[model samples]
Target: MLPSIIIVNYKSSRLILDCLHSIYRQGQEEFEVIVVDNSDDEEGRKAISGSYPVVKWIRMEYNAGFARANNAGIRAATGDIILLLNPDTLVEDNAIAECAARLRSSEYVAAGVQLLNTDRSPQITGNYFMTGGLNHLMALPAVGRLIRWLGYRLKVKKTNVASAEGLVEVDWINGAFLMVKRTAIDKAGLLDEDFFLYAEEIEWCSRLRRIGKLCVYGDLHTLHLQGESANDAFGSSGKGYYNLSDRKGYQIMLSGLVRIRKQFGAGWFIFHLAAYLFTVPVYLLVTIIRTLFLQPGRKREWANWWGFSVNVLRICGFVPVILSKKPHFYKVL
Candidate 1:
């Protein structure tokens, strides 16, 4: 069966075009490409459609975010295999075909390719489900080393699938290059629309795991230009991981709480929420100390952390709204 590649595009027209170019370069692959344009960029649509006349384009009435837009594309896909690919990524050297073939031959329901950074270094493409305790522990400085040591001692499964020797079973695969059989999607249902952005894939993967296995192929590589869309929306952080602007960080934390509540239970949700609340004062203390003696220029870091804490607390008021069955967009910005 041919694969249907679904790419959800926001305002990244140029990036999407580049992604399409990479896909077209893969020789003799009978696949359909669906572009769900959330921003309704007519100019981009014209440019892309002019070059690739076979490309299917779906324009949303408004900015529908990732999960909803991708759901729309999935519904319109004609192929049995569906790939949710990021617009900022470039598939390398038969990666898409190989990944699709791997999924077709294996018993796994869903699979992700190894993601590479812009410099071709391996990016973490798979991860274990986040626990409340691990989330809290990772917040503190120099805690990653301790977690790695403990993880080694405990023989806990590794989180990065790219480093594995072969097809590795994982808790969840990153949405950037996820390929799944249409049957699996039909059984599991579409991604939850409540999540406007981050953590939606994790929540979806949790549900997908209920039916069959999820794995990542270490040899299949895709270069992900991570955070370009995010940098456009929120000012550039100039660093990888853990350095997000106030609004972006707030959205992530808020969505994470929602995911925890839906997947684990209210107990895990409350634990993480309370952990965020508890850290407010701790961050405030650090902010004051840095302002007093340390590099004042670095004060933005603490302020961003404080802003995230404050916004998380603010979400408490909307708990009732979020819990209801009615549709509500969870965007903070």
Candidate 2:
């Protein structure tokens, strides 16, 4: 039997239905698909329940956020392999088959796939490690472009028709189209519920990587539309990260890094914190002006900056707490 593909949806009613139809277009029955809807209401629930009968659907009365929503589906999954896919992506024929086949063949690999933009442009292929030290970078538009440039020069994204040949280890594959083994997902535990939106994949894959290897099959590809980017539980105005989401993502990553550093004694946590502070002015300006990403108005973006700054202050408040009181900060095992 094939793995059960889990798609977490919110406000993606039509897209979810269409995505399910496309998956069937692959003409493969080895896999099952489970869709978890975190729509604020049951409109999507009611509409899809009677309409789509091919798969299992879970309608959540309250929004459970992104990672938690997927965790819900993961727990219900029965496939030896578990595919965490986005609802907006259009899977080309054989995409799912190839990803599953490649991952199954590799003991070290947790997941792998080729992700493309809506326009068929190659998005990052293969996995990557999310760095926490001074050199670790968040792939914002600027950083994304830089990484792509480096990838193109290195010819590392995708090389040939060999689906699994090019990459061996990655920080993390884009959650947009990740295929993992059931054993790996179970070993890694489930997706961390702490991440309501961004960086959850990085955190999840980071743990899986500790166990074995993670990569992407760049030679094959799936089409991800620009409009349907994130399958988030909560909503994004796109102006920037909301106050609550920003606070959660930042603290989640910081908390992870602190735990890791205390064990390794990396001292890079201080360097990373310094980087975040320096980035404060830059990201603050980015948030305030809404320079590049077309989202909300400038005023809305500034509010996001103000929100992030508030969280940073709160995080500083806890540094002494973790150091003096909790003392369990470094214990990863």
Candidate 3:
């Protein structure tokens, strides 16, 4: 069965063109490409469509976010396998076809390949479920280190799991290069529209995990220019390690809260929310102290932590909407 690759475009027209070039260069002619243009860039559509007339373009009236746009593409897909690819990524060699073949032959319901940075270094592709207050605890400096050490001592697989066949069983794979059977998606349902950006894939994987295994082909690789598309949609300052101060970071933290609420229910969600709220002062004090004496140039770091803390509190305002099943756009940008 051929795979239908769905790429959600958000003002990254040039990047999407390069991504398409990489895919077509693979010479794998059995697959179909669907470009869900959230920006509705007529010029980009004309440029891309003019080059690849076979591409199925679905133009959105507004920036519909990742989940909604991909859902639109998925609804239009006719292929047996569906690949949710990022517009900023370039598939290496036969990574797409090989990933599809692996999913078709194995018991895995969904699969992701090894993601690489532009330098070809491996990026984090798969990870275990972030539940049970683990997400909240991991944000704390000391507790996070202790938890990691304990996890290491217990051999708790946090990221990718190694197998003899070069496939790793993971809780969820990055959405940038995820390939899943159309039947599995039919069972698990489409991407939840409530999530405007981040953490939607993890929530979707939570449901997909209930049905079958999810794996990653460790050998297959794809170059993912991480956050390039987001940087295009919402301008970035290009500072900080995670840049949690920016609008993008705010959306990420907020959507993560939503994902916790949706996947684990209200109790765990409340626990995490309280944990985050409680740690706000601690993060603030530490950053303030570090910025004053230890690292003067770390003002940006302090701002990032402060912004993240403020956004966490802001999430409190949206708790009612987060808990409800009602559809809402959680766009921070």
Candidate 4:
């Protein structure tokens, strides 16, 4: 049997329906679809169920966030392989089968496909998880370029490929379309609920990596309406051509801090916090300059820095709570 596909829906009924149709049409009778609705509304539930009656719909009592919502579906899944798919993605022809075939291999613990944008251009293949120190410094654009140059000259930098002809081992694949073997899940346990969003997948894969190889197959591709659901969290204003809205951006930053605290230690969080604080003033000046002379796209870099500066304060002792409701507020998606 093929893998059980679990999609967490959050106010994307139309997108989810299109996603399901693509999967059903491409794979024929090879897979089962499980929809975990975090929209927390009967209207969405009714519409989805009424349209796709055969789907095994799991209505969440309330918005369970990404990690918990996916876990709910994982627990309910009966297949040997579990595919955590985003509701805003379309599985291309043979893509599902190809991913399942890769997961069936005993060598791979988890696998993901090449993600394409709406225009069918390639997007991020995958990324190495934040390991602190130099890796943390790599987040700074100019510093990152210098470090990459130095590492490449020293022949110590790891290669990241977006157009590989075959499966290649990677640090971690994006959560938008990840497939995992039942053995790996059993060994690694379920996704951590502490991470309401963002680095949840990175944390899970960090554990899974201990079991076996985690990789992305360049031969298989899928279309992702990137950040579609995430936009809803910040509302219409979040629709900037670049940069996330203040709320969404801060949530991601705060979640990264939480992930660091979980994966590394308090020391790592403090180190990154210091880095954030040091750069805030510098970026503030840059934001002003860009806003004055550069195009609108450049303004996003400004927003990112400004947002990070504020989040640093929140993380340090300035604010008692990151989100007023925090984990629960984050769950509303």
List, residue by residue over 1-333, the lDDT tens digit for candidate 1. 689999988888799899888988776447899999988799999999998888999999988888999999999998888999999899898888888887988899999988989888888898776555354235432333456688889887555554644778898988888898899999999999988888889889988999899998887789999877766665545434454336666666677778777887767766666666666667667667777778666857676766656676787876776555356778765
lDDT of 4 by residue, 1-333 (tens): 658999998888888889988877764767777889876757877877887787888988877788999999999888899999988899897798778976796588898899888898887766675356345454543334566678778886564555556767887778999999988999999998866777788779888988888888888989998888877755634321233236665566666656666577667766766666766676676677677777555756765776666656765652234323244233323
- Could you tell me which 10 consecutive residues in candidate 3 have the lowest summed lDDT? 156-165
Rank candidates, TM-score, best first: 3, 1, 4, 2
> Which portions of model 3 miss their true places by more than 4 Å?
130-133, 136-165, 237-241
Give me the candidate number with maximum lDDT.
3
Identify the runs in model 4 with alpha carbons over 4 angstroms from their true place: 133-159, 236-245, 288-306, 317-333
Q: What does candidate 3's lDDT look like per residue over 83-200, in tens digits?
A: 9999989888889988888789889999999888888767878878754637335645333556678878988755543321377788888898888898899899999998889888
In what order do the candidates fall by lDDT, top score first? 3, 1, 4, 2
TM-score of each: 0.90, 0.70, 0.91, 0.85
Instruction: Assess the local accuracy of residue 85 in candidate 2 as a C-alpha lDDT between 0 and 100.
Output: 84
Query: If both were scored by lDDT, which would come out higher, candidate 1 or candidate 4?
Result: 1
RMSD of each: 2.6, 6.7, 2.5, 4.0
Q: Residue 256 of model 3: what lDDT?
A: 79
Select the stronger candidate by lDDT from 3 and 4.
3
Model 2: per-residue lDDT, tens digit, 1-333?
Answer: 667898877788778778777777666767778888876546776666676666788767666666778888988888888888887877876778777877787775466566666666666545433234322433222333454577678665342222344554565677778777888776778876644555567667778877787766666677766334341422332322223335344544455445434423445555555555555577665664563576555575666566656655665655654444344322110
Model 2: runs farther than 4 Å from truth? Answer: 130-168, 226-270, 281-333
